[model samples]
Target: MPVPDAPVTGAHRETPEPPGGDRPSRLDPAIAARLRRTPDGLVAAVVRQHDSGEVLMVAWMDDEALHRTLTTGRATYWSRSRREYWVKGATSGHHQYVRSVALDCDGDAVLVSVDQVGAACHTGHRTCFFTELPVSSGEVAS
Candidate 1:
């Protein structure tokens, strides 16, 4: 078994740890636990197009949602409005097949690159971030 706090190497990288723990200890549990969840117990997930590298949409994920995403090789999220778990494209047939998942160093956010099947946005657009905010002043934006 790998020692605690050690850098996991090689094939072990692909082997996800078994879920249902209070916190992950295989790597640095403290570091991973740094991920801040909202008072409602949610974190932000950034989903992207794997091949074209197009920015898709951002969503919220709870622990179960995140676990489902990792184990199933698909993008899953916690629907804040519906008050339920959602597998992307489950209804629209525009599913997101997860290619890889990465956590930022701060453990505050997740990036999921996926093979998007069709339109990623519910608005029938390729991405949800279609409208750009007007830049009133270059200095303000900078």
Candidate 2:
């Protein structure tokens, strides 16, 4: 089955226009080629819960992770700290089933809508970002 939210041919895949009418080109062949040529072409991902507006996770994507995510319709990420591939919710049963994937104007980041199961954090929290640092206070607290 085709992955949900995967871009279909003829669909409007244009990147959003920036302020002052400055808009980068969408993920065309040329841009895709350039991305492939980069040493770390993969970008950031924003994983949101499909039913709720809750953000389940934010992860980084490498080329392999992107490919796997597109092919499998599941969230896949490159673990920079671990130096390996991480299929979200794979081990913990907190899988994120992709609903859609969008690229930013510069193609440097991605937003993913997904059907999240269980918790998105290994720490048993619902989200990977469990702690919030007070911006004004500059204090780190969970």
TM-score of each: 0.72, 0.65
Instruction: Show the colliding residue pairs in model 2.
Output: none
Total clashing pairs in model 1? 0
Q: Which stretches of candidate 1 lie over 4 Å from their true place?
A: 1-34, 137-142
Per-residue C-alpha lDDT of model 1 across residues 22-69, encoded as one tens digit per residue: 322232445346667666667789989998889899988767678778
Show the lowest summed lDDT stretch of 10 residues, model 1: 2-11
Model 1: lDDT to the true structure: 0.70
Q: Give the C-alpha lDDT of model 2.
A: 0.64
User: How far in Å is the alpha carbon of 115 misplaced in model 1?
Assistant: 0.5
C-alpha lDDT of all candidate models, in order: 0.70, 0.64
Return the lDDT, model 1, position 32. 43
